[model samples]
Target: MSIVLIDSGLGGLTVLHEALQELPHERYLFFADNGNVPYGTKPKETVRSCILSAVQELVTEETKALLIACNTATSIAIADLRRLYSIPVIGMEPAVKPAVELNRNTGKRSLVMATPLALKETKYHDLVNRLGDTEHIDSQPMPGLVTLAEELEFDGPRVQAYLQETIGDRDWQEYGTAVLGCTHFSFFRTAFAKFLPPHIELIDGNRGTVRRLQELIRGREEAPDSAAAAGPVVEFRHSGSDPAYRERMEQALDWYRRDRERAGRPRA
Candidate 1:
């Protein structure tokens, strides 16, 4: 049994990276629906169907829990997933609540960078509305970052050009924090930190999501047995099932590891 992390592409590796750091003893199954990659641009029903189909293919009696690591997929299909599955179903959302709290009384807004489909979702809007800080929440659709991440372009002249083109003109002084709403965007945190004003802090939901998974797993009635205790191992799979793509997944993980090391961020 393993905690399953699903995404449209390699973005969920960000979540898995965090999980491995925090819950090092647990096994993980990372499923990337790369055959139907980029769910952020698709229609709501289409994204939902793809997510449901992929989840159906991945979930099993041995599956411990499911984490929809893609913000776009979570916005579109988390409800259906929760209803259909008995295991704990965790979903991603922009860390708007914490961003809002952090900016409270700071006279600064939070800039949320996500994909078009995710930003357009009612779930995203409802979250901002529920927080009652709609005026202070700004959203920018970053569909390109997902493509760049899938291509393994984390940082370079091309990445810098893209980031600059997207946000170069903005007045960073008006924002207290920038939220990496999409998991793919987390890959470029280093780039974002360097480009944005030093005053603006970067935030994401990856750590929070992993913490939720820990709480749920610990709350479970069953005790850890041999199967559960066997691993900090990760089994990677994708809808495409291409050996090349699997290699890319491994490469992405390695990239993330190196990125963290370069940033001097603690792994555990």
Candidate 2:
């Protein structure tokens, strides 16, 4: 059986990249609903409906697990998905607790960067309250970074402009860590580093989600018996019939590979 990873656009590709490295034996089906891109800007009801429809269309009988890789969709639609799908459904959330812990460890402030919808979600507020004081936790809405990541223009002038505008000239030295609350933002970790001070750490939910999926897959005790077992494979699909979709995805994969190689890290 394959695993399904759903997102609004290229954001989920970041999650898929991690999954490919850590769960090399598993087959992945990445569904990008680019027709309704930027779920973070949509209304809660609209995002939920779109996510449900995407799941219904993408999931197959062979599907063993579903991972919602968008923070906006997960915050609003994850419960509905769990109720509807019998398979294990994993949802991506901001790494607020982890970032806050980093702050405590370093005796510096924690910052949480997310889309407007995620920043306003009750779950996010509760997470902040549980992990740290509201005054100490800095939550900012970064609605444009997702679009930059989708365009695969990381570490460029456009990205620098956007980060400068979004982050302003705040005393970044005061912050010890920044939590990337959106999967899309995870793709541009290096760009974010450029805008922040060197001491500030960056954390995201991509690796955590991959680990969670691995744990669930192991618990199921399922073995690969299908044709896909011959090798690791990733299937990409998008709601919009964009002719450049395949080309862009290939480019993204290449970038992912280069990043790993430059870091001198083997496949996780």
Question: Highest TM-score: which candidate?
Answer: 1
Q: Compared with the true structure, what per-residue lDDT tens digits does model 1 show for residues 39-97?
A: 99999999999999989989999888999999999999999999999899999999999
lDDT of each: 0.89, 0.83
Q: Estimate the TM-score for candidate 1.
A: 0.95
Q: Candidate 2: deviation at residue 203, Å?
A: 0.7
Query: What does candidate 2's lDDT look like per residue over 69-117, in tens digits?
Result: 9998999999999999889999999987777766675677888889999
TM-scores of the candidates in the order shown:
0.95, 0.93
Candidate 1 residue pairs in clash (backbone atoms < 3 Å): none
TM-score of 2: 0.93
Error of 2 at 165 (Å): 0.7
**Candidate 1 RMSD to the real structure:** 2.1
**Prediction RMSDs, each to the true structure:** 2.1, 2.2
Model 1 regions more than 4 Å off: 221-231, 266-268
